[model samples]
Target: MMFVIFISFTLSSITIINGVHFRGGMITWEPVSSVTNASPNITLLIHQRYAWSRSHIPCTQTNIFNRDLIGDYSFNPIVCLSSSTQCNSADYNSQRISSDVYCTDINLILGISSSSRSQSLSLRNNTKLVLAFKGNDSWLSLTYGSPAGEGWSLPVFIDLTLRPGIGINHSPTSTMPLRINIPIGILTSIEIPMSDNNVNDVIKCRWAKSAGTINGLSVDECAGACHSYTLPSTVQLRTFTKNRCQLNVTLPYVGYYIVALQIEDFSSNSSTIALSSVPLQFVLYGFDSYNTRTTCMTPPRITNMSPFPTSNGGNISVTVNGQYYGVIVAQTGCVNDTETYIANFITKSPSAMKTSSFPYAQNNTSQYSMELQWTPTIDQLGSTLTFCAIAIDVNDYSSDPFCVNFIVGPEITTTTDTTSTVTVTTTVTTSTLMIMTTSTTSTVVATTTATTSISTTETTTITTSQVVTAITSALSSDDGRILALGLGLGLPLILLISLLA
Candidate 1:
């Protein structure tokens, strides 16, 4: 009896130390270089992003800005589980990419720290493999549910076999906040935006399985969080078609539900094999506003303003090696001012992107804003980078994710021409014609014509050359004006000018 009690105590201690830190995370990869005859090997850049409890990881703003690494946690390398033997080599199998995760951001209010890291690997062409990151048992306890002692795992499938028409395969990307709060007893729909470089491929989403084999790789996708919540009889859990993953749910009780989903890309709707499988997991907290007397409390919304020219899941273009600046604005809908205020703005951005300090007030109203600044390097040319953000109120109610794609390339300029013809018949009278043209880029061209009308028709041609000159002059005068204006008025006006320019 003494021996059994001692063994049990030691096992319990190990569980407490190793099981409670992981919240959620995802794994994605992109081709580092194009496949060519000279270089038969395909190089891929693998990205891993995870969130953990701040109490365990201990991350701060300084750590995030400095790109510090969380060195305490044990390394859990992502390994290959595919049946193919080519990708199962020692170098490609379970090599530890990094000692620890890089601290990218931290939320003190929620006590969650976000980490992201990337590593490069090379593999031969036509290699099909499935990679997964599996962890030991124990997830953070839920508010209204029992402790989840089951382990967690994330897997992504990679297919190197070129498509029939398309050249290479690129995996789909997705983003969301670590946690979201929804009102109980009400139907709500959440849309998870999915973007893929292979625009022709069909993207779909489904609930993750606790144990399954994807493309001959057997593993547990999501352990304790697999189908953890029950939805209404009439509501479907998700609707995935046309690069969209929408979850229509209505929680009956006030508690936390873990949503685990895998996004996969197929050649077509009828294709049986998936080109890639990316995992996305997050938490949804249900709260009751009626019980707390919060009569009118609604989630915040991203405003459709100047910088944000398009709505969620829209595309914004940026130039290579050019500075890009923008702002995200959100507003709450609580009538009773004391009910809630904007608490935080959680974001998932590229490693080099920088954001302003969060929880900033916007003129005492319930509106809040966060500034984003990034300069795409020359190496990032022709790449589509994604940035996603969400706003959380003091009551923990979160808005829908607002994600945008930044296409990097040369600046795209649009020009519109306006031509007008004026015919005046005057006998022995001289008339002066003044034509002014304005362009969308704020370029103005003025033309003056003095004509002597003696029963003759005069035709004057106004070409777009004048508009080009005006635009050139404006650009020359504002060569370094983006930097100056950005420093003075912050990034909002600068991004507006970037969009207009």
Candidate 2:
């Protein structure tokens, strides 16, 4: 086997090289703090930190780079297209090494964003840099810094004698190599794109409908026992499955009792989990009766909506209103990404005026919106707001919802006044969403936006004489029979009795 030894220097560094160790044609590092690791064939310390003009981030760069390590040692490592900056602020055990070959067997280890690995060294965009490290005869080691606060540690110089390279050489031993397992729906540390495993790969999830064979009382008798059905194996996280996902089972009886459903996912040890499908959601009623259509509309073209309101942190329902630009929606993301709301609301009122509520509700074809109102019973000030919408395709399958930005508005105040005031001011942000009404039969799309401000005031007062008159009128109106018959008039009574006869 042609052995290839690779060394990686994460950042520009200056390490005191104590000595070097070579065995079986393998060269390693040993740190004694006695010898300084020099850029090979040159006199400069292997690592040196430079200021992006001494302070600012976004990396420091130089138009001309001097690779000659023999001189001043002050070559602001030239920026290059393939440097480490491609990484988001994060903690990575990645590296860049000098093109030289003295201790080729050992690679330098630089940083790992314990939090946002890419955040550190977020230096100037497209800035060039070089990887440098420290070494010696006894062990191989290096230092690293994290942008997301695990900060810098007292140079974590690994012991090379332990097995592999420089200052500290720890052998890769044990069943798992620092394995970390995160639960399917747990709140995880915010991760950058490059450092995380696909959330789907980490979990297996599926939704199920209620299935029972018994009808009426018989199905009620079979309540505890439910037959299981699996979704198409391909149905996955962030992926929608709209196949006729019918839950087939034996029905003993059928009645007006409500059918219930609960969603589940696979756990670490292959266990089942009953997730919070709050109120045990009802996806489709009469689920057992295949091909059941329950008052479908133009699929609720949500014209516009405000973010869901809340009283506590991260506990708001996701709400948003907007016109149907060339899209259809199914649900909105609420509290957690999973706190979804079915976009298609079944209204008791006839489809608003002209549009039909078929295949999908098609009210005002272009723009429409609703205000998500809530009065938090608890902590109103600490609440956060989010607005997200899940669009559905013509195939009836839902799409990944996109979230909109939300600004928190102050609570509405009610004040008492004895006089009328015209300048009552309340700030309502006008949304970018606007729908244009045309005299023609077809719907028109409006993209223009305009800003307008408004203010208002109100007054209240009461008097005893008015209250007494109101009471008398209320009493008279309540006596409907006498009022209709004209209590004290002969002609009116005769006419009423004749009409009644």
Per-prediction backbone clash count:
0, 85
| C-alpha local distance difference test of each model | 0.63, 0.21
Clashing pairs in 1: none
How big is the RMSD of model 1? Answer: 17.9
| Superposed Cα deviation of residue 248, candidate 1 (Å) | 2.9
TM-score of each: 0.69, 0.19
TM-score, prediction 2: 0.19
Q: Which candidate is the best by lDDT?
A: 1
lDDT of 1 by residue, 1-501 (tens): 000000000000111246566677777777765564444566777767776767776866567556666633355456566654655642365433542566766666667767766666666666677777666755566654443546666777877665666655778766666677788888888887677778888888888886766887776787766765323344455655677778887777787666778888888889877888888877777888667444446677877424657677789888966777888888886734765677788777664677776766678576777888777766557766667787877766777788887888965566767553323222221122222324423321212232221232333344465645654454444433423432444445446658999
Q: For model 1, where is the 10-residue window of minimal lDDT?
A: 1-10
lDDT by residue for model 2 (210-324), tens: 3221111111111211112111122122211321123222222221111122222112224333111110111111112222132222222233332332221123231222121
Q: In model 2, which runs have C-alpha deviations exceeding 4 angstroms?
A: 1-259, 264-279, 286-300, 303-344, 347-501
Misplaced by over 4 Å in model 1 are 1-17, 36-39, 71-74, 89-91, 94-96, 144-149, 228-235, 304-326, 334-340, 352-358, 372-383, 406-501
